[model samples]
Target chain A: MLFLIEDAINGILMGSIYGLTALGLTVIFGVLKVINFAHGSLLMVSMYAAYWTVALTGWHPYLALVIVAPAMFVFGYYLQDIVIKPIFKAEQDVREPITVIIVTTGVWYILDNLTLLLFGPQYRTLQDNPLRGRMLEIGQMLISVPKLWGFAAAVLTASGLYLFFQKTRLGRAVRATSLDRQAASLMGINQYKVYNIAFGIGTATAGIAAVTLVPFYNVFPTVGVLFDIKGFIIVVLGGLGSIGGALLGGIIIGLIESVGPQFMTATWTEAIVYGLFLLVLFVKPSGLFGVRYDW
Target chain B: MTRRHYNKMAAAIVLILAFGLPLVVRSATYLHILVLLYFYAYLTTSWNLVGGFAGVLPLGHAAFVGIGAYTSTILYLQYGISPWIGMLVGGVLASFVGVLIGLPTFKMRGAYFALATLAFAEGIRVMVENIDRLGPFVLNGPRGLQIPPLKLGLGNLVFASKEPYYYIILLMLLAVLALTWVIARSKLGYYLNAGGEEPDAAMALGVNVARSKLTAMAMSSFLTALAGAFYAQFTLYIHPKSVISLDLSFEIAFIALIGGRGSIAGPVLGALLLRPVSDFSRIYFGDTLPGLHLVIFGVVLILVMIFQPRGLQEPLTRAYNRLLDRLAPGQTKELGT
Candidate 1:
């Protein structure tokens, strides 16, 4: 029973991390209608950013989030403006999506290699926080405090985003565009501006998540690929374009990963998660919360 | 401009290159590079059946390749089954697995299909790493499998020299090219192209879009698996990391894209150009900078996408046609029908 509890706690913690990663991907997909294959790379970049900030400035890793988040947001906004806008402006055909995919994949490769160039493929961890060693004990179960903090932060961020989308004009513009870009344009909302904001916010979320999770996971170039895959799974599972679905999907995948290893080997954990994804896809092609789009 | 004229010219050129090149370049290093080039070209061309022609964009093709390598090597080592026969079994198995993945995922649109394929590929890699026991057989976890030499022969498909491997891969490439050409002109190709252009319209036209994609996937998987078997025989070692890595899948996709997807000539050109760059990079710069070659390669890929997304082949063709016009200005009486 204790073991099960521990696994559940561990699973929830990991799920929080997955949720944070998926949040950025889901936002980008929702607003831009382009899957940013480079989102993971951005997360990787942010992790390095946080690592370097701590290494150079001697700031607390958590405090470095303030610096990295806005920087990532600006970087993401300009990146979309410069790289992604041309593809979107192109005539829609069989090749448009392919062009976007290739461009972003190119960016992914560049960022990955750049990380290798900058960091020399060595693993870096932040040693500033004593919380890295702290854990919370509840009923014979031990849970790391960093994870609890991560979960709290993820919930706060998700809630903040929910409120923003529900209440703010910009948020409504984002929603309107996601629902129908042409319709939103007809409403006098600048679709391109909304895309810029959405992309910025999306990348910023990844940056925030990176800083939060860096204390626990080591920073590396390839680290983003694994998280990116997991984020993709979450985005799909939660039903693309559904923020609420991303949270639910993250928790479910977390539980599966946590409990799966007990029944099978940990290495097979990913397979089982993917098997579940395939199962969900087979049962509901639209995903748990996906609405069928006419396009 | 007739099909017959083009075929004759192509056949004559291929024959000349095949028969004459071996005589001219007797160096073992060049032969080794040729063998590697042919191997990758065969794999990339096979990948084009699904990714290029059908437009499925499988980012996890390396999973099938890994499966083929592991299956053939394991069969050869444990049961003493000749690799020639083992390769067939492995190819069939990979095809079956491809069909399984395709049946469910093919129902979705482009992005979803790509994501599903990527997940499936990564899942296989993870599973291979964790599988502890299979009756009396063990996968050796992450360490991989190694096969001993079993004498060179047609039955064994093992080669004693780089020359034999080179010939074998050349034959494989020719076979794949011919097969791709046939498929490109068939009714199935029509369905694939239609689905790739517009899935909903294809469905409205009474084409089983999912089924067509699955067929292309199965064919591609089988060919990739066969190549994997050939690879294992040549290298005499197989590892999940080596065979099923995301890098391998990306390389396959990159080659197809760079050469020009949806063209028979694309994968060939892509592999021919890119593989040498990769090999040369590894040979020279790899030891000094670790990942510098990849960084440069990434930059080149970016530049290619930004400037010439149609790939090098289209621009080259355009330039060549312009050159022909320049050289034979009076003879060019309306270049095309």
Candidate 2:
């Protein structure tokens, strides 16, 4: 019973972080209406950025977010502006351009392999960091301190994003474009600029997720591929564009991964997750938290 | 001479050249490369049935390939069944699975369908990697299954030389291309083209879009599996990472896109162009730069999508027609009308 409780707690904490990782994907999908296959690569890139920032500066892992977030934002903004915008312009008539998906996949390949070329595929963990291997003990229960921090960070980031989207002028512009790009454009909103900003915000959140992960996880070039697929499943489960749905959906998956090994092999947990995803897709293609009408 | 006569003559000449090249270029290394080239062309052409005609990106075709390779390999290793028979079993099984998956996923839009298939494939791979045995069969998990080059004959499908493999793949490629040509002029082809462009319109016209898409998926999966079985026999190895990889799936899609999806000659053109680039790049920089080829693939995919979304086939086809016209002085139809 105690072990079950321990696993559940671990699941919740880790699941929230997974939700945080997927939050950017949902946000980008909400606005851009493209899957952004490179989203995982972005997370991988940000993890590397965070890893280096702490490695070089000897600061707390979370502190690297200060540099990584802004840099990632800029990277994403320009990536949309330069590489993806041309395709979007050409296929302006398509509600969701299939070409953009291919382009993003191309980006995924480039970013991952380029990192392999530059970093040589070695797994790096933050050394001499304040959060390294810290654990919280509470009488027959041990919880990872980094994961607890990650949980808090996830909640804070989620709330911040919600408020940003609901209250700010830029946020409203983004919402307007997402709702109806043509109408938003007629009302004088720069649709392309909104896409760039939404992409930036999404990348920034991935950077934040990277900071949380760098403390507890090993950083590597292909690390994003693992999370990328997980993020897709999570976003789909939570409702593609729903913020809270992403969190809850992530928790469900996290719970499966965390608690499933008690009954089956660790690999079986992955199958269970996939099976559940397929079930949801068949039974409720709109996702658990998604609106009935297609986005 | 009429354009039909010229086209027939040109096809015969190309066929003659293809069959005779192995005799001229006797190097084993080049023959091996050419065999692989034909293998990819065959795979890409099979992929085009659904990816091109049906216009849905099924990113998990490698799963079918994996299925074909594993089924045949297991049957051969354990039951002493010929891989030739095993290939058919795998193809039938793959088609059934394909139809089952397509039933639910075919209704999904582009991104969702792609993701679902990807998850499905990944799920299968993980399962294969985890389970070392199922019932009486030995999967060996991540260790993979290797076929010993024990028997060398037509019946065993194992050969000592590359020429046999080369001719087999080349014939397979030609046969698949011919099938594609036939399908392009068939009722199913028109239905797929119509459904791809406008699903609602096609449905309104009573086109049975869902059934047509499912049919394409079934055929595509079956053909893809045949290639997979061929791969297992040719390489004498079958592994999850090598056979059931997302990269293989993506490469198949890339060939279709680069050569031109929905067109008969597109996959061949794409395979012809891309296989050489990937193969040569791997040869030169594989050890030193490990992933340089993939980077080049990514760059090429991006450049092609951005500049020539329809693929190289469109321009190449036009250029071919122009050349034909120049040769026969107005015998050919107008180019790109």
Using all chains and alpha carbons, the TM-scores for the candidates as numbered come to 0.94, 0.98
How far residue A30's Cα lies from its native spot in candidate 1, in Å, is 1.0
- Per-residue error (Å), model 2, residue B209: 0.7
- What does candidate 2's lDDT look like per residue over B237-335, in tens digits? 889999999889999988888888888888888988989888888999888897888898899889999888988888887787777777778553732
- The candidate scoring highest on lDDT is 2
Any residue pairs clashing in model 1, and if so which?
none
List runs of model 2 lying over 4 Å from the truth. Answer: A293-295, B332-337
Q: Write the per-residue lDDT of candidate 2 for residues A217-238, one digit (tens) a residue.
A: 9998899999999999999999
- Candidate 2 is graded, for docking, as medium
lDDT of 1 by residue, B72-154 (tens): 88888888888888889999999999999888778766677777777788778877777755677668878888777756676
